[model samples]
Target: MKVQNIRMTATKKLIEEAFTDLLRKKGIEKITIKNITERAKINRATFYAHYEDKYQLFDEMIKGAATELINVHTKEENIWNQKQVTCLTQAVFEYLNQVKMSCPYSYQNLFPLLRMKMLNALKTHLESLFNSNNISEIKEFNILMYSRIIYDAAEVLVVEKTNLTYTEVIEEISEIILDNNQSF
Candidate 1:
């Protein structure tokens, strides 16, 4: 039973990776079931066995990446240290970087669906961590504000509009978060 689950998971990952590779090289509009099946070395029939269409595959890929990116930043219960936010920034950047690195033309393809959720989720993470701060408690407004800064910084990074390194961006935001300092 466990083996079957593992096998399924592996197959799913394979499909996502294959699709991502194709997307990286070309625009999403250019990808087809034949393309993915060819890349994954699976049968065309097997492709439909897993997903309804390319968009479905893309959503699964984004969601899986989203969960992973969210987990990297907000997964642990730390004191909102520089390291944790760094992880968050790195996770997000890494996701975008992968797309950009492999599929520069296609990276933006996921942004429309991915952007808002990423922003909101980052805000939630910031607020959650802020609420748990030992010295300063976070309010809703505070979280929203800090989250905007983080989102903007992250967006800049995603869009290649900023020169800040991922760690530097997180560090700068930490300062902003500290400035908004409140106690619980």
Candidate 2:
């Protein structure tokens, strides 16, 4: 069973790498399942067993990336604070910048979907932190609002090419969120 799991993991990695390669070379629209399977040297059945479609594969990849980014920037079990918030914003900006570099041609077309997925992932992470910290008073709406504010601020700083340096941007963001000394 362990060996089977290892093989499955290897096959999924192959599929993801193949898809990314195709995405870089020919963009998403031109990259079909057949193209992915051919590049990955896997059968259609194998591909289907792993992912229902290319879009699902893409989404899974994005979610995995988001999770990794969150883990790197915001430690698990940490309560919400100015540093954590800034780190989370940094993660979002870094992830989006990576997407831009990874698929320059498709970035514009994929931005909306990528933004939505990233926001959802960020919200999930925030909700986990909020829950673990016993912030029971915080509602789902508040979580969503906080996530949006963080995500949008990061987006503006990254995509808009603001005059402020990264450190300065994060400092301002931190001030904005932590100004009232409101407890998270």
Candidate 3:
């Protein structure tokens, strides 16, 4: 059972890497199951066994990446703080930067999907933080609002590729959150 699980994991990783490579080279719209299977060196049946279709593969990849980012960034603490927020902002910026560099041609095509996935991940993390902290003063809506605010602010820096340092961006985001928290 353990060996089977490891093999399945390895196969999925290979398929995902192949999909990413094809996405970088040919963009999402042009890539097909055949392209992915050829790149992955896997049969169509194996691909179908893992994913129903290309859309499912894409979505699973995005969600997996999002979960990974969240896990890596939030490994230490459940409470939200400026430092954690800074780390999250920097991690996101770095991730986006890598995506831009690696898939310059497909970055624009992939940005919307990446943005939505990242935002959902951020929101999930923030909700967990809020719930764990037992911040009864802040409403659920406010937590959602703050999550969007943090995501949008960081996203602007990422999309613009501003010259601002991560620390500078972090400071700005901290202020935004602090100011908003005061109101709530």
Candidate 4:
């Protein structure tokens, strides 16, 4: 059983790596199951056993990446504070930059879908932390607004090349967030 699990893990990794390679070179629409299996050096049956289709694989990839990206900045306690907020904002900027660098073609092709997914994920993450604190002073609408502000700022940081250094961008994000939000 353990060996089978290991083999499964290895097979999934190969499929994921192949899909990612194809993503880096071209859009998902151009990538087929045959392409992935061929690139992965695996049979079609193996790919089907792992994923139902290319869309499923793509979704799983995006979800895994998003979870990892969010987890990197999440605290063990999920505490809501200025520092936590800064970390969350920084995570978005850094993660987007990484994606842009590693998968420029995929990033360009999937920017809209990526943006929506990232935004919703970021909002949900922030909401969870905010809800945990149960701060009566900060309303739910405030959480939504704050998440948008942070996401929008982070998006700008990734899209534009400004003179502002990374620290400066973080500082600015923190300032805007902290200034508007004092309760958290």
Candidate 5:
């Protein structure tokens, strides 16, 4: 059973890697199941066993990436502070930059999906932070608004491939969050 689990994990990783590679080369719209399966060195049966279709696989991949990205900046007992906020913004910027660099062509194709996933993850983390701080005045809607602002800023930076340094972006976002939260 353990070996089977390990094999399943390995197969999934291979499929993911192959899909990423194909996405980079052919872009998502052009990538077919045959393309992914051929690149993964797996059959259609294996692909179907792992994912219903390319869209499902892509959705899962984006969600997984967003979760990992959020985890990188959050701790078990994350404190809601400017520094942590800065770090979170920095993480988002760096993650998006990495994605842009790694998959230039496909990045544009996948930006909307990636942005939404990242935004949702960011909003969840921000809500947790706000709740932990006992900031009862700040509603869920406010938190969502803040998350959207940060996400949009980060998206613009990534899409533009701006000349601004990570620190500059981080500081700006941190200031925005700190300033807005002070009202609560």
Candidate 6:
């Protein structure tokens, strides 16, 4: 039997929204379960049943949002292309534009956990490119480094969107990947 089961969608959504609303107003350190429960209008028992504490609740919310964003970016059915990558990058930019503070806060809070998930997804995409180009597999260490760099770069880029156009950002990344492949 699983110990953690988020069975009730409505209650879960309420708890999550309460945290988001609270987060927008103040930082996580200031948030407590009492505040969340009161804001959510749900009892503490329901909150505890789904989550262990405030940190988990914060993690759950941030993680859920990260997964949703990643899914939105990677869910395209068509063959991968530069156009699609550009569109995905622009979408990232647009998402940041819409929720500049919230998105970065989520990224900062959840990136370490979410980074691996995103990196794995990126590695699959990069693997496809390697296959298409007849390139060899990247080493595990290199993939790990690349993944972390990408996460850091994207997070920084999201916060610094006003300084760079989406196309400019995408082109710079493409150039770096191309240069890296040529060097290897």
**Could you tell me every candidate's TM-score relative to the true structure?**
0.70, 0.79, 0.80, 0.79, 0.85, 0.68
> Compared with the true structure, what per-residue lDDT tens digits does model 2 show for residues 1-184?
9999999999999999999988777667778999999999999999999999988998888877877887898874387888788889988888888877788667666767788877888889988888888988778987787788788887786567678987887787777665667555
Model 5 poorest 10 in a row by lDDT: 175-184
**lDDT winner, 2 or 4:** 2
Candidate 5 Cα lDDT to native: 0.78
- Cα distance off (Å), candidate 2, residue 149: 1.6
The alpha-carbon lDDT assigned to residue 107 of candidate 4 equals 70
Per-residue lDDT tens digits for candidate 3, residues 21-65, read 877777677889999999999999999999999879888876667
Best by lDDT: 2
In candidate 4, how many Å is residue 166 off?
3.2
Regions of candidate 5 where Cα sits further than 4 Å from its true position: 161-165, 180-184
Among the numbered candidates, top TM-score falls to 5
Ten contiguous residues minimizing lDDT sum, candidate 3: 175-184
Model 3, runs deviating above 4 Å: 1-10, 161-163, 180-184
Q: Which residues of candidate 2, in runs, are more than 4 Å off?
A: 1-6, 131-137, 181-184
Itemize residue pairs with steric clashes in candidate 6.
Answer: none
**CA lDDT, every model vs. true structure:** 0.71, 0.83, 0.77, 0.78, 0.78, 0.61
Candidate 4 — what's its lDDT? 0.78
Q: Which parts of model 4 have CA positions greater than 4 angstroms off?
A: 1-3, 76-81, 181-184
lDDT tens per residue, model 6, 79-157: 4445545544544444444454764344345444455555565555545545666656556665555444455556567
- Candidate 6 at residue 7, lDDT? 49
Error of 2 at 148 (Å): 0.8
Quickly count the clashes in candidate 5. Answer: 0
Clashing pairs in 5: none
